[model samples]
Target: MLSNILLITAVGLGSFRSVQSQSTPSICDNSTLLIDSRQVLTTAQECTAVAGDIVIQYASDYPATIEFPNLESIDGSFLSINFDEDIRVTRLSAPKLKSVTADVYISRWVNLTTINMPVLTTINRVRLNNLPSLTSANFLSTLESIENNYEVTNTSLKEITNDKLPFAVFVEIFDNKELEKFELKGLKNASYNVALRRNKPGVEVSLPALKEVFYFEFQRISSLEIPELERVIGHFVVNDSTVESLEAPKLQNVGLWYDPSISITNNRGLVIQNSGDSESLSFPVLEAVQLDLVIRNNSALRDISFPMLRRVTGNIGLEGTFESVRLPELDRVGGIFSLGNDEAGFNCGDLQAFKTNGTIRGEFSCPRYQELPTRSSSIGESEKEIKDWLNWASPSTGFESFRSMGAVAFAIGISTILLVL
Candidate 1:
């Protein structure tokens, strides 16, 4: 009887050991895990804690749903890439994921429609690219900071809400076709550059609270209005865009790097007027430009008025068909002053004074010579000669004189020569 009881006890102990051996294994056995398409994640215990990187490569045969409800932080990078032309992964949810110590890259997932990372707030860097079908990306609602760069390119991301990321070095958004508006209403500062280029037409960019930046480049945008931008430590360039109007009400200084600091060129539809309306382009508080201030090739531009512009440390080049050019408050220029196209004529006395006082560094051009004394004439005599010349060169017949002045300016390298009438 004792032998039979011992045998039964041993058998029961063996059964319990067998059950323990068949139970679910811990998924965190290794530091790194590479989940391929052939594997299946059936339970949450499959990924409890990853000490190292977690790379997920999607294939067509993989499960459509991927969720890690218990994952709170990744000690290493989190990378997801789908090479298959027909991606089967539709949803990825990591509800409790809060931080990633390294970079997070999600690229080439053509068919991925949704991504949910509700509590993710911090990461080292982020790159979201080449996801065409991804129209909505609200996964970064709580993202407050990034250590390095933040780049979003070639995606369908439309808008970014007011998220103040003060730790980022640079933010670049380009080649997004369907993006219509971008609101950085909460961003008050950045450490480096902010470049927005090649987006859809008529896109409105509002940076209401941006106070300073190292560099600011806005290319191929429709309209740019930065009401609170005060200073740029580097260059400020707006080129090849369809922006009809531009206003930076509080911009006080530009070109901390030096020459070619402020360039507004090739915007065919840009206009400058002083009508006290929103459509008119003006920089009321612009105090100085450290380098070149170029305004060229804007065909629709009619008038230019810089009321409070005080100084330019570099050259100033203006080449366009403008009806009127007014710089009533311009006090000094450190470099050359060159203007082409004889549409608006200027008084030679003003040009001579600016040149004589060492305010203009290089060649100055005056396309239309309105009135001037002869080589052997005095100042009083020149005044009478100018009046008589004005009678002949009336507004109706000014076109011929403009043509003549252009030819003469081209020949002599000076737009107008103070020749006797």
Candidate 2:
């Protein structure tokens, strides 16, 4: 009986010693909490509310689960850098995390599989990189806004769909090899650029209601569908892909009023044919180009028609062997009109009329000509004589001469005069 009582007392002392050894003053008063590999975090309750930054990194003997149920807000950054190759953190959950006032950078977690923050809604910036084994990120459905930049690169994330993050300055998703589907259905505008490059083949992109962006570029995407996109204030370039079809029905302007250019090149299998109509590769409402317009190196391109085009302030460069080219309503071109094609059926008369009207400011070149032919004046005339003749045959003189002759005689006389001039 005495031995049993002594054993119970000893057990109580040991429990008290363990608690005393692991206890410390609350770290909430400090602005930064650095959870390093050397210190073993027994429970997440030790540091509940951090006034500033929280860095959880390099845990050599990391726990399997880390939960911060009471963390409501982080006033500064939350950065996690897990560089330990053998650390085993399977899940990180913050059930009540509502906002991060600054950046959130989660990178290089080589073995982390999932991140769960269900009610997180606001963040300033987010960058996720080099997490190869991470497959899922959950509880971010309530996220509404990212103020600056959101970039995800070199991860194993298969898909991302964020409806509430409607506006961002720059969004770049690249080098995610297993990413197959990306849907930002509710995204309305991007202030700067949205670049999706070097992703997996056959991946689908759906941005249904996106209306405007400054710059939009796609490289090596399988298919693109932005049905309601109306304008791009900068360049819109699609290159180095096998995208079979591109549909941006409402896109009207490419560049801003200052700088304008559009390039759709090297998409060999792209076909822009309407289903029930005969229009193929058509920009129906594109009315202006303030700078260069280049359409080249597309092998499967057969037809191009710009019906409502009224003016181009720069060069109009057309290459490759297109079957038909139609610009019926093109009224003015401020620079060169160049055509480089092996096929010889394109008529140069319309361009000649533009040249004669002084609409094209630069030379026009085609496959058949080293240079366009000059005026048919064999005998050399001095510059002064040409000026004198132009002055003598003014509009007033010509009108007075026509009034003095009979109608039939006047027609014959004008014809003879034109031939002599």
Candidate 3:
């Protein structure tokens, strides 16, 4: 009986000690726990301050400022907060803030390695003017806006396309000289004004729903097709490429005026040779052409035909070795006609048939026949004396019987003098 009672008393004391040790909070614990300046804790749990949370202030002790020096990653699935009314959450900077939730807005965030912020997909605002050392950013799969008329400028980004962001008032991706390929496939139904200028070399851009392109350079590309391109409020240049054919039927508007005359120059391999025998091939209707209809240096070119060309208000010069030019309804050319440096196979019979309003100045010859010699205007003394004498006597030469009348008058005068003697 005595041993049983001693055993019960010892077991009860051991249970009390176990509860006391487990209930003690550690120094890192901030969940509903209060600590004095000199007090220490024994738990590793982080703090969660509610709206009416309180903290003990000390005279010589300092509050925490976010200084993440040796942090590898912030992987805690916990909620963090500030204790005071001003809500200074400055003590929580991490080197690798990966897979974090909630829309976090921080100013002067200097020590972050990379903002792989897939969680912060919809950013209402971001201010990085004070963060000079920030290097890279991993955007969300559906990142929308960084404020209105905003972009990520002055950085080293290779390819940027927010698959979730397509609609805005204005968007600019300018001065990104190192960026190569940009595909806005998510912008199929957007009604925004987008401009992309001065990209890197060998870049192929595709914007199917593009309405207004300020300027796009397909200089080093092989093929380009925008079947739904409707308008271009500025210039559209396609230079230095091997684009063989260009057929855009739904391309309605181009420049400030609809289908304004465009210049496609310096492309050696670009052949816009329409082959169909239709009445009119459809091209973008242009108001006025500022430069010449520059068709030069295309050696493989055979024919130049525009069946629907109602009016050519500018100069149309076809200078290469083209076989023929067939423009059926062409009228009202604003300048002269020129065809130069074509050796053989010159069949301008269709152009020569139409009585041109402008002057024609070429020798049309064939392989078997020599070119008809150009008639020269003679200005020699014999020709000049003949012209001057004819001009003086031409009016008198028109009178009826003037030659016979003068001969008869001289004979009558001599007959009368003989009769009187």
Candidate 4:
């Protein structure tokens, strides 16, 4: 068994060595006419279409800005080329380049200001090991430069801060751990179905056009502004930051608003703020929600109101707010709902007129009564008789007899019987 293991290990090492020997290390070149797309025209066994007459092969030290005049594809990989200087690709499509097998580099085309490479849909990997002077990934335009699956690592990048890269896909920026801020300004038009997590500091988190967010972790941010968010499709975690308030315009469920089985936990400093100026927030279709609504540590909060609220499937925490607790038009509550220890001492007897359904379970000892409109004695007696008849029709034996008596009384005193007992 030991000999067999050693043989397998030696074979594995040999294969790794063979692959390493074939791999070409990229070198830096400064003097070259950099292409506007930043792709190096090179040939390999992977090369599909070589130049017919001028067989100029690319080397590892090619400049980052060097452009190819007649090169069609790189090593049979899906390639996009921009021949014109119109700042947009005249012809951008990748038929031969199916997937990027290796990372291509543009050495140093000094005249090149911005690389417009939007025809690329997917790249296996990208390397920025020597781009010490590069300030932006401006080559990424629209959705073309983004791989269907992209990985950016090992660089001196200060920002993935593109306000406008429209590639709506998943990206993992691990290994480039020094990257601080990521801006989603260009992503405003994109419907990104993504999971962005575990980035280091200065990572600016802003998503105004996001509608559906799944398993998002903003663990290292000071402020998160997602104003246009409506639905959360998965678990949302906002922790270990100085976040003051969370506001969403049409936001209903953090994870399936109707599920009533999810929880919001470990967010000790999250504060919820109303977006509009005193305009009541509305959730018309929200049915049942299950989560710990922990609004305790937010001492600056004033009011917690769910006017048309239907049901809560978890613990509702209204512990550490200001004076008054008001939900004047609450319809129903499904689980244990409580008002935590308020500094104003729970002076909430004003909403009695709006309680439609649900068990009142807190220190509901304060019941503020409102005097209803009075009616004449005869009308009251008639209404009492009708109520007695309805109750008697219920499934209780004694009550049924009472209803029968009420019906007889109603028949006898159609005018002046003044039905009392």
Candidate 5:
């Protein structure tokens, strides 16, 4: 076999020249402190506990504040990314780095401003991207814990407070063009996701000690507080906000487990009939919504209440211009039950007795409502038309799940070509 492939290509070129001659690792050796030249940034300012990782690249004459005065703890990540040029460190003083078991990536640092890690607490992830002259990041007020994500993008950092982080799974802050304000005031719980988009448009958010969450998305807000949230194991979206009003005084539930979707879009003066924006499409004490609940194009929402809603395992779309539509303890609605109100003595006779009594098992519109179907963004048979869309939310393009595994893999490739004839 060609001399055993030339002795395994000479033992893989001698193991790539012994890993390119151990890419310069010395100070507090546990490897990786590749601070590219300037004598490895003065031997990484004499590391003070750095098991591994500490990449600060692109250096041709580095300096201008890079102090690490006796760095402390960093069993991993602490990168200072630089895609090619632009990385003339403005400031990165690790004032006694507290902890960073994993990531603390600062990407595309376009002339970093200041990141004096004034006692970083506990971290597993903290991605700060495209920093446009990062406006000081005093360690986000001593974080307490973060097992996963805590992202902040396109920063100029106007405000970002954390009354000693309590708990979170994933926190995203988007395109921060001088981020207005944010408050995580001792987050109580955030089991999964918490997203915010395209910032700097009258932003002012507050968590006020969140109670529970699995997924929460808020966009373009003016002021949206979560005064002690209750629960949400899945979705709870509030879109294109101008945040006129939308209270959740201890909400109850909104989709848990499989089949879940809730989108309250284009909030333009969310619900207003009385003085207080008619409870501002309130949820004084919501009940359940384990599947699809789309509230569209908010035009000063006329009036709509879920007064202790009962259940909805799917679809329950409600369009704008409403006068009054309350689901007095709705029992059930597993699929389609739309309402496209135009106001003016709006009444659908108790939702047509919930589809003439049966608790609406499927398709049932009210007061001439339409356009209520959109999920499954791909995957066969037009994704089963979207109604009770759930095959884990689209993915098994029918055909009886590929007809017995494509007929036993085409009968084992025709019995392996008749046993080679």
Candidate 6:
């Protein structure tokens, strides 16, 4: 009995000492914990899990390196932002962090250099913006799944290639001046837009497994490869880009959404091809474009050919300097079919049959087939030209037909000499 009491007393004393060591308040024990100074950060070093948000921002004299060695999870968001531009932290590391239930938004940190979240795997959303000094982030390589969206802008990272991520609702990766290559090898579809704009000039993009998207827009890109893309529901725009050859070998239907011109609605019209700088633009097996097929301003393409295209429900506008156009199987166009070129020998005689045969349901105008203007003069210019040409013409029977009333008219008389015999 004596030995049992002594052992119990020793165990109780050890537990009491352990509780006394943690005298400071836990940062995770509240709904929101703000870490503004080194002392505040030190007080949270013992916490293993944060039930609420962890906001770290608006501090100038921060430690050189901030780390959470024991933090495992955060039910809320992880935000680090400052409007006054005073955050001077160099590295933000959570080596053991694996999940964040909410977004991980880190923005406007002018002096941050590295984001060393090595084992982070899942999150809701991530927006890393205006981190000019951030060179690399280890979490991007290990992330396999995400929820809402992923957006990154104004960073110095060179490449973002992920073969693990399969799907995302919205993605915007732009204004990263040093990004060189972006490849999403496993992404099968994007239910919404996947836009990459204003990135590096010569960035190479490869979405080999993408089959469909709502709207796919690429700008300032040099090389793009989408070998398996089949459908674009909204718009497929490649503007201000320098891609040499664009071959959508499997793309069949473009603008398969609700046609805006069908009803008196507020939706915008669908456009398939807006602008590109490709030398060869070919959609070999495409059969239909539900709405407008605006293939214009493709300056370097020598030909606009869709050999198997059958119908265009909306307008078809093709403006380029092409040597020839080959749309052999086109049967109908619901709206205007406007085709113009700057080539000398470009002809449109064969296309006139579509209009006469009623294959085109709306207005049609091809090269050399448009009707000339019947009334080609203004009223004022016509009167001036007519009066100048007919020098002997008298003014109209009006009082002030002439503009200058002070001028007088001169008459020449013909004299006849009579001889008396």
TM-scores, all models, native as reference: 0.71, 0.70, 0.41, 0.44, 0.36, 0.78
Candidate lDDT (C-alpha), each? 0.60, 0.60, 0.36, 0.37, 0.67, 0.67
Expressed as tens digits, the lDDT of each residue in 1-421 for candidate 1 is 9999999999999999887554433544446656665553553334545677777776556677677777888888878875576777766778888888887788888776667887788888888878776676665546777788777777776775545565467878788888887776666666687888787755677777788876677766677768888777655677766677677777777744222222322211112222122223567667666445666666666555555565664456665655555555455554456665556453344445556555554556664322211122355543543343323211110111123123322100001111111
Which regions in candidate 4 have their CA more than 4 angstroms from the true location?
A: 1-157, 163-180, 186-203, 257-290, 319-321, 342-344, 348-421
Steric clash pairs (candidate 3)? 25-42, 26-41, 26-42, 26-43, 27-41, 30-47, 66-90, 66-91, 259-286
Top TM-score hit: 6
lDDT of candidate 1 at residue 387, scale 0 to 100: 40
Ten residues in sequence with the least summed lDDT for candidate 1: 410-419
Model 3 lDDT per residue over 9-72, tens place: 9999999988755653233233333323322211222222111212233212423433223222
Query: Which model, 2 or 3, shows the larger TM-score?
Result: 2
Candidate 5: give the clashing pairs: none
List, residue by residue over 182-253, the lDDT tens digit for candidate 4. Answer: 556544322223433444543556766666544344544545666765554443444444454444545555
Query: What overall lDDT, based on C-alpha atoms, would model 1 receive against the true structure?
Result: 0.60
State the local distance difference test value for candidate 3: 0.36
Q: How close is candidate 2 to the true structure, as a TM-score?
A: 0.70
Segments in model 3 whose C-alpha atoms lie over 4 Å from true places: 1-158, 162-178, 186-198, 213-218, 257-329, 332-343, 348-355, 358-421
Ranking, TM-score, top scorer first: 6, 1, 2, 4, 3, 5
lDDT of 5 by residue, 1-421 (tens): 9999999999999988777545333565756777876777777777777888888878767787778788888899988776454556778898999998999998886887889998899989899998877888988768899888888999899998889898878889999898889888998887787888888877889998888877778777677789788776666777777777777767677644432232322211112122222225567576666546666666766555656666655667776664555666665665677777665555566566676666666788876677655444343322243233332222111010012112211000000000000
Off by over 4 Å in 1: 1-31, 38-49, 58-60, 257-279, 329-332, 342-352, 368-421
